[model samples]
Target: MRFVNDRDPLPLIEQLRRRYQDQRQIAYVERAGDAVVIDFTVHPAAATQGCGGANGTGCGCSGG
Candidate 1:
């Protein structure tokens, strides 16, 4: 997906990287004036199940 913001989202992107680890990826697409464009993608195979089972909480606990 594409993310457009008035300011660079570098800090948010870093947070996402830490949260998703190798499960997701983010790229800087472009910069125009005060607008910043980013590309965020999730690897499909890594998203089949949640860390909290199928509940999608990603809490890294068993039993949803």
Candidate 2:
């Protein structure tokens, strides 16, 4: 997933880390003017390890 934000996304990145643990990874793709771009990558093995939805985002899972 590509994230485009108006400002630095440090807090959001921290939250992603807490939510997904090592299951997901992120990297800075770009930082131009007011746009901050980040790539959120999810490992395939992260799918079957938790109680969240198919993408493991806890959107539709009762275990959240």
CA shift of 39, model 2, Å: 0.9
Task: Determine which window of 10 residues in candidate 1 has minimal summed lDDT.
Answer: 48-57
lDDT of 2 by residue, 1-64 (tens): 8999889888888887877777788988988879899998878777565544434456565544
Write one digit per residue (lDDT tens) for candidate 1, span 1-64.
Answer: 8999999977887777776677777887888779899888868766565442222447565621
lDDT scores of the candidates, listed in order: 0.71, 0.75
TM-score of each predicted structure versus truth: 0.66, 0.69
For model 2, the local distance difference test gives 0.75
Q: List the residue pairs that clash in candidate 1.
A: none
